[model samples]
Target: MNKVFLLSLYEEAVRVSKPKHCLPQYFNAFSKNDRVCVLGVGKAAADMAVEAHNYFGSNAYGLVVTRYGYENTESTGNIEVRLAAHPVPDENSVTGANALLAAASSVEPSESVIFLISGGGSSLACAPPSTVSLEQKLSLHKFLLRSGASIEEMNTVRKHVSVIKGGRLAAASKGQNTSLVISDVVGDDPAFIASGLTVQDTTTPQDAIAILDKYGFDNASPLRGYLANAPLLPKVKGDYKLVANAQSAIDAAVEMAKASGFSTRVISYTEKGEAQEVAKRHAQIALECKQQGKPILLFSGGELTVTLGDSKGEGGPNQEYLLALTKYLDGEPGICALAADTDGVDGSKDVAGGFIDESTLRNAKRKKIDVNAMLAEHNSFGFFESLESHIKVGPTRTNVNDFRVIYVS
Candidate 1:
């Protein structure tokens, strides 16, 4: 197990999870004359829309909102493309949300609205309720991300504060709704993906309040009253399909590992928790695997949280996971690991993730880099960048959360 082998495994995992490969199969039954208006949103929205266009041709008409710099420069006829902020809502996000609502509203009842929902849509298409100002939403967004809340929890709060989320977008539409979702949340629940733009939200205002309180948001926070008075939308009749998810990506990685002549097992596709603790557990698994005296690969998928405890250096959860995992490995031979966000961006950084081998600690020591200190400051990116171990693949135009793989030989 080395950097090269680990990278190949990562590439194979991403290859199968690509939107072009995963989205087209789900659109076969959709009719070209169905008067479908596709509303694509998230990191993969542009690519997903392009695929839908291929199937529906001119029949497909609508809009796609993706993160800034994530739009497809290629042909996207009849489907308007808009760039917006992600992980945090901006003025552009509100504009995108308005456009989606307008498109959905103008369509005839005979027509169908197809929403291409993916990970970043929560912030990418922000339409805060009239009572909740954009600044309030943005402030809450920052608080939630730094609070180390899960995607489910964050979206739970988001749904309560938005005018277009938690099925409100679908509820506002006169036409039938259909969602072609790229899930990035645990359990692949459409309600949590992009804050459930088309799916019915079961979470109540109380639920949102509880999550905010659990994360230590002050009672003075504007979210308290907004959520308390926010109305929940009724579940609508619509076509909702899971086009791709973290499990699919993990399965692809496992298959690739087995084909490469290593025994492989997918431990869990929905693993979650604090990043450092998760890495320690994974390190223990590698130790046990090494003792078996057989080459083996262990793969898992799911987003991990990094509670930034005032030590703000530049790094995402994946990077923090790898840095912690490397320390636990303690220069043990025949063990290597890779962890990355499937969307090709980890946290707020441009890098995808980080790669670590048994020799990572040794290499860092030789380079006079203090691994522990870097980890303490949440500087995984800085540490990896100095060692040239940061994985950068740019945006993959598809997201299914985080992908992780460990190889032992």
Candidate 2:
């Protein structure tokens, strides 16, 4: 496997998430009314707002909440950009959450309400439950981050705790509401994306409680009471559109590889599960494709979760997935692969993610790094650093979950 070409596939996936290419189609379709409110929440919200401002002129005005480094609202004239915490809710997210409810308060039956929802919005844009404090929410969010809880599980709990999630924002709009969503989930399920802030949620508060328990996320703190007395949401159905998804990243990677004269095939955009387990499956698939004389490129994009079991590790799902695959592969064949998050931030760390091939195992071993021990610690970043394979892109201002490319030829 050629590591140089494999890394290019990762770059191409990220390049597609930029504003100009993947965003304009959705932004252009949205016609802003003079009396419209264009509020948003997610990693891409601020960037969406900026484009909305440019497309609709000064008429579109509203607020958007994003992680600290993910905002792209530098020159938005009419729109307000709010930075908040993500993967964990802090006071800022509480403020942003309150702002979300506040932003949706002034809706009228005749006025157009344009809601921009995207991945990472659940934690980035939040309003805590009446019985819960921001600190409590933050603590719980931190636990979930390291708990290996799936996005569905994490969001299920979030929907009940949030005053604006689980269709509450749509309920807030009350009148004419239209939501433009950029999904970072498999199949682009709006309910799971951003906890369905602007869409209706069929999952009950009981479901939320069940998920928290199912994952053994039961922290005997302020959470028990908070979950017991979760928020009440109103039923609402609003216009929704899926503008971006994991498929977008996969398609982009395929094109980029093809442009460079390499055969590429999209394996799946619906890969999900624990990072290591999925990696093992993906590794086997790559080997099979190589042996069957169908040597080409394989791509996949989806969100994966890492369940931490009392381990101190500096890693995210993508990096962890790679570590698991490379360790098992152990230079078994000539397979090179690159995996990363499209948002350019894997987990809460700097740099998008990392890549590997046959030589990766040899390099890590020569560097005296225990690959299996690192995986056990969930420290894929450190292992990759030893191999100098960590890919860093800071914040791309857009997220469509993870992008993985397996080059067979």
Candidate 3:
């Protein structure tokens, strides 16, 4: 369980967890027709659209909105690619969102809309209602992210502020809207992934309002009123399919660990909640298992939300989880862990995530790095930076939320 070994296993897990390789397999049944539109809006939409084109060739036509640098670097002659802001709304997102709505609206009822819905679409591919400006949405999104709100809560707010969320895309399609979604939120609720653009939500305006109230934004949010007793739907509903999920990545990691000469078991891909707390629990579990006990390798695929207390330092939930996990370990032996977002970006920073072995904090302590203070500030990036342990993979251009792996040998 050294750094190199831990990194090798983690990288192997990440390579297997990608949305790019997984998306194409689901499109095999899709027919290349004379009138077919393939629209995507999420962190993985760009790659999803590319795969659709690869499968359907020129038969696919439509747009995909993604975070900047998340789009396919290679030009696709068929699918239109649009880049926009993420975790927050922006003018570019609005424009791209309009394109999707327009495309859906103009399509004849006989045509089929293949909607590629993945993680991060809720913010990156969004058009706030005409009454809500991009600035308002951006401010509120940022605010919500720091308020200890869950991904579901954040998207609940997002669905109300936008014109094309919570199955509105399906409503706009008028015809068939087939959703190929990658579950990110806990429980894989279709309504929360990218704000459920093509999936129906059973949540009511009360649910949305409750989220706002929990975040202490009930009075601040302009759309709070609209969320009270609002319709229990997206105006129209469509079919949804879970293409790939956290279990896929966790299973891959477990198989690879076994092949690498270590017995492994995948805990669950649906884990969620506070990052720091998650790290502590994982560390405890690893401690309880001696190397002879199947050499536990827990993998989780769901997204984790961090409630930033007073503008916490730069680091995503994955980073925070790792740093916090270290606090519980106290330099214990034969314990190593890796936590990262499947989308390749964590927090507002560019770092994907980082690696930690039993010696990680021991090494950091020698350098006089206050791990507790840094963790308290939720500044996992700064702490990792000081230790030169930050993992940077740039945008993997796909999203399945966060992927975590822990190994004991």
Candidate 4:
């Protein structure tokens, strides 16, 4: 019953953000005679393109770039879908960016362009400047992922290094632009989503340099030279709408918890920090809730970071959070919790996340699994897989960052 209830909350959180649920009402942005060009980028790109294609029918034609496995198999009228690597950009990412730039440039001044932007767009539509090779860009991504920098900070650096990011895409377009965004970052700022693809950029190259310095990159790094010569981005105009976000998912989960007869408290809709440290604090809250002896549910959203200094692990932030949480929980009864990315993939693993309850620690001990060692090595996926406790929901098709729920009864 606990598992069922927790999973239900996750499903409800994801359902509200689907393009079908949140996009149609915005269709008024297009008109009968307008030539429509749809551009989409991110894990939700294909799905959002399908929605746009359905609304505009044969009149809509453009390109969409998404993660390799996240393409929507459903028939989309005339939009072409391209697959690319994420978190780490590949050659295909460059191709996707060039294609999108061409599409945006070809739009007539009288036509209207729709930009379907979402999380993961940063990597899915990468276009590094000629001074920097794809290998260097890939290395920078690997460093940032392990550096514990926040999404905004990482994208600040990304914007300065890329050709298409930082409003360059918007600058190339002749059509009036309208961006429909699914926000995965806390604060949901348009300037940071997909590194402000269709919006104006306010960040300077020095900002990217500062982020690099903060992350321990030496002054001698070639990126510093590249950023030093980075051109200023032109001011651009676009109507940016946040169609879905972490807050919406949290609101839906709160409603479901009330319907389930549990009093609920929202810890935050913008939770952020290191995974283990956040888990420790959350564990304390869960323990306090249990002591009160009343049915209660706790909810939070926002992405967490895992700084991998030396350990090479098969897990994401959500899985790491759950693993750390299980240690702090220490098999406490009447409490169960789950943490997962709303996008369905947590870290680079196929698994969504992990789950834990009163019996988790005990079961680990019985199975002779060393929880402490696993956590230290950042191998949460391995630990959960050994116990068959990880959640696997392939490509939810939308990303709103991390969703966490804790229930005490």
Name the top lDDT candidate.
Answer: 4
lDDT of 2 by residue, 1-409 (tens): 5767777777666666665566667755555546678888998888888877777778887888888887673576678898987777677877887877877887777777888878888888778767777777777777777777878878888788778888888787755888888888777888889988987778877787777787676657777766776656678877888777778777877887788787777767888899999899888887788778777888888888888788878878899999999977768666777888888888768868898878888888788888889988888888887788987877888888898887776
Candidate maximizing TM-score: 4
Off by over 4 Å in 4: none
What is candidate 1's TM-score against the reference? 0.97
TM-score of each: 0.97, 0.94, 0.94, 0.98
User: Taking the tens digit of each residue's C-alpha lDDT, what string does model 4 give over 1-409?
Assistant: 3887899899999999989898888987578456699998998999998898878888889999999889897867899999999889999999999999999999999888999999999999999999899988988998998888999999999988898998999888999889999999898988888888988878899989989989897677688889998898879987888999999998998998888777999998998899999999999998987887867888999989988887888799999999999999899988899888999999878988989999999999999999999988999989899989988889999999999999888
Q: What ranges in model 2 sit over 4 Å off?
A: 1-4, 27-33, 229-232
- The positional error of residue 13 in candidate 3, measured at the CA in angstroms, is 3.9
- The lDDT for every candidate, in the order shown, is 0.86, 0.80, 0.78, 0.90
- Give the C-alpha miss distance for residue 285 in model 4, angstroms: 0.8
lDDT of 2 at 50: 81
The residue pairs in collision within model 3 are none
Query: Which candidate model has the greater TM-score, 1 or 3?
Result: 1
